[model samples]
Target: MAAVIFLVAAAAGGGSAVWFGAQGWGKAANQSPPVLPPATAEVTRQTLTATSEYDGELGYGVATTTTNRLTGTITGLPDVGDVIKRGQSLYSVDGDPVILLYGELPAYRTLKEGDEGPDVEQLERNLEELGYDGFTVDDEFTWRTAAAVEEWQDDLGLAETGTVELGRVAFLPESRRIDGLEVELGAAATPGQPVLSHTSTAKAVTVQLEPSDLADVKTGAEVEVELPDGKRVPAKITELSTEVQAGSGQQEEASTVVIAVAELSGDKAIEAAAGYDQAAVDLIVTTGERKDVLTVPVTALLALAEGGYGLEVVAGGTTSYVKVDTGLFADGRVEVSGAGIDEGTVVGIPE
Candidate 1:
């Protein structure tokens, strides 16, 4: 006669614990005929990818505020969406242009013949880029560099003092599109006052995730962005930053968040996002993948009482347990390999 076998079914990848009590017949001298399993599934081979999706905004990315270091009335302001490049007039103060230069260091002091520092070198680089040459682009600001600056000032109709005065120029890392004007045309332009806000012209997706969610994400990681029109485009993370957000109420606690900026890489993304300036999108990042491997539903795995894990192979009206080794677990399927476990092998599943 058949006898009952108690089995503990634990899903792979730390799934919940399940206990199953069933009747079974084994091929032995005194055992009865075999009993069929209630349910069965076949082992199959396919690629599986583990991914996480987050809400993102598709736009020109973050905006940086351009503060005024000059003192005068705001005579001219660029219209919103105006792109300012190197050697161009970003805005005007008292009818004089505050030139835009490409550099990382801000103009902190007046750069003259005797000043020697990184800011001087930055100015010299911009002067050389604007076609005013003859001076070495170094940390030292010599008379020759002042001569080039005089020439540049002459072109902009400024005083030919041969000394670059503070507040005469604004330094940015690159060309930027005007995002918004902070002050009106007639507003007073005082030192340290914000003038306008700008951003890069390239299309990007911005995602804010919890700090713990950023463990697998890094700069230069490739990801897919799903646009509003159901188009998928490839992108790469270009920047990452962390910020602490203060709580609004006393009962709330402050939280740290990671900001991820991903720039769109190909023409497909540009074309798909042509009509919209900003839209909601989804950022999909793949964390793990496995290709061409035998897999089974996680529920099919049985925790053996002896040790390790096993699967009940159902064949020809009889069932036998085959111990198997497991690998990556993804999408409710576990990568499995062992003796007698091949593609099309029917494995028993709990009803």
Candidate 2:
């Protein structure tokens, strides 16, 4: 098949310059001598990846604040950076420990034998994991459930009330590393006050992006993290969240930022980030990719006198224009395809 050639006149400034139009080619009277471009490059078939790097921080991802649901004198507090797990004491209030339980529901009310809800089921699951048994883990709390709770309370050296009081247990999604202490030891622990802050124990990199950059970012996408020491490691996007950042001045406007959390996998990735408790890193996310496709330098593409784009193909001692469709543009190269474009084909680079 013959390739369609769209001939257009070169602009007055130079032989490589061409006029842009909405419909058809320019008249032959507008043509100029030396129609070929001064510089030429050969089309090659290769994989092209369009990626963007953003500033990120390597740490334990995001921190969440734990508030006090019980009122008492703060007897004990965990040190900063302490890793607290399930069945462990998060903090002490009035000589009683606030046990840590793994669950998504927050402790809202006093759970007694007659109580029945998802919160009850959550508590029962934790209790079972802590070695308490002889009761079914269900939403309903019965006498059998109270027996197990009593046993747990006894093990924790608490009063065998058989009823879980509000604030007796703190529920978190997983084990957490204590980030900071909001209250000091011996301080008064008031209800609804922040007691401590913590984050997941796993290593992660967090990157903030503007709204416009979020179009290609999705969960489970693979990315690369460049550590402070110049070492690169692989990571995957596990979570995405939105945060509102306050402006510095009264006249400034608050902006909504998307926070991407990428979890580090394997021993190498974990060990590479272990040295830095919190440090700046670079997150390289691939936005687009083209595999085994013919590509040319972006400069080779000409804004044709017709509506679309064209490339001046140089073959033997002659040159001609070939209409081409452009794809992923990355690293100064663009994916191009047309009837006459192929691997090793020489294309003119417009001046």
Candidate 3:
């Protein structure tokens, strides 16, 4: 015998309205008005996913403004979308190339053969990476380091000063794809002036999630990106930023937005979104998923009088009541489990 998760307590003896509370059934004699027929549903197994979709922007990533450090006329600028690599000119100032180097520490001062600091180490590390040899990679710049600098300078057509001064090179964490330009050619470029903005070449989708959605948005969760062409691409949550921005509306209150990054992985995703740039897409976040679970139409649920819930399990001509616990509720079907219920158990529904 299956234990009933009675939503309402069944009476010991037949009484006026036999059913007790929210979801209990009346005594079989009073269950139906002669006109309405009984309806039934099969209890079966299937997979389910609890998810939601939101509008998202598809692109490389957020653009970071690239600022200049040395004052000069902006003689040359890379075309938007140019992929700048090491030894290449990021932008020319007074016709001298501010060579691109891969590093995180920004150059803060004029570096010479005698300087010693983390900046020097960054410069030396880049020099070695650029194929300049004979200089041990270290913070202390030696004579060999100066020689390497001179060779690099000659290659870029600059005076071989054998020293790196602020503004002669730009250090980024890695290669970058120029996303946009902020200044025009021949514009006066001053220290700390905005030059341009860029992002990684890889494709990603960004979402500005509302506060309520944060609970379902987790790093590493799988998501589906619906492209503008109506095609779907698989992606994963790569990053999340909890940022607070002040509102400019009449209320003038601050609001926190969860900024998420969904990276499109695999060759298929790349091929699908290869031609797109700054396009709108749909992001389906799968908060939860379940498979092979017992489920029935939501209508089968009866709020029990005692607090839980009960399923009106119909057997033969009479309805046998059974208590049940609920699980995932999706697509008008809900998960349920209780004693006595089987894959083919029939449950009752209102007419």
Candidate 4:
């Protein structure tokens, strides 16, 4: 079998490119070159990744406000980006350390020996990990629990009272990166006043998608993020949710948007985002993909006279058309296969 060739061409046939069939190629082989600007594309092998970009922002994830639980003057505070770890002062009120403790329980009442609940268990757990001994970590606040609390209090140069005062500490999980100071230093620290805010130190991107786009943005789905400086980084969707956003009034429409968080994986995106605490990034969410397929310029497909589509192969100034089976169409290209088509086949694109 001699090498077959095609001259692809199309400008108005169903708005798609047409190919000179093998018979047509044979006819054009001995003829003069067609009077048209030469425009052609090779039969290239590539994976067509169907992706869509959405507006996104880079930061340390969602921010939640930390409130002051004591009545005093705010004396000291940590700056934004400061990591308040376990057993450290989140903020000082009247010179007393409002310590950071790890727990899920919200400090409601003063935890003393007589108290018996999840808050006690939470305190005991933190104490157990912070080198306090001789106490069982459970919901019951026994004397041993009070002993541990007093030891911790004494270590912090506070009163060695057996009770853990509600304002003496703030409960958080592990550690947090201070995001903002909600209340200024020297301000009166009133109960329930927003003292500061914080978020996890990890870098992440958040995207809000229209309801129609939610299907492709699933939790755990892998994605790519383009930073403000044009750096691309691979990321994974760590969270996804659909919630109704309340409208201004009862007459207004309550819109539902898909909220997703994508965790960035490399230092490139991070470095590009330096000095930007919260900045916009573009998200390329791959919605569909096909690998190792024979593809050509979507315009290369000719709505053939014989029916279906074809591509024109050009060889030695001769052009012929070969009918092709078309598949996925994306990015101005279409997946194609046929009897005499392979990668490297130069197909013409009609101007």
Residue 113 lDDT, candidate 1, scale 0-100: 92
User: Would you list the clashing residue pairs of candidate 1?
Assistant: none
Ordered by lDDT, highest first, the candidates read 2, 1, 3, 4
Instruction: Per model, state how many residue pairs clash.
Output: 0, 0, 5, 17
TM-score of 3: 0.83
Which lDDT values do the candidates have, in the order given?
A: 0.84, 0.85, 0.81, 0.80
Span of ten consecutive residues with least summed lDDT in model 1: 13-22
Q: After superposition, how far is residue 7 of candidate 2 from its true place, in Å?
A: 6.1
Q: After superposition, how far is residue 190 of candidate 1 from its true place, in Å?
A: 0.8
Of candidate 4, the 10-residue stretch with the lowest lDDT total is 1-10
Candidate 3 weakest ten by summed lDDT: 13-22
Model 1 alpha-carbon drift over 4 Å, by segment: 1-41, 302-309, 348-351
Better of 3 and 4 by TM-score: 3
Error of 2 at 123 (Å): 1.0
Candidate 2 has its poorest 10 consecutive residues by lDDT at 16-25
Error of 2 at 210 (Å): 1.9
The TM-score that candidate 2 achieves is 0.86
**Local accuracy of candidate 2 as per-residue lDDT tens digits, 123-199:** 99999998889999999999999999999999999999899999999999999999999988999989998999998
lDDT of 1 by residue, 236-316 (tens): 998899999999999999989999999898988888888878999999999888999999999888776556677878877
Predicted structure 1, TM vs. truth: 0.85
Best by lDDT: 2
RMSD of each: 4.8, 5.3, 4.6, 5.6
Per-prediction TM-score, please?
A: 0.85, 0.86, 0.83, 0.76
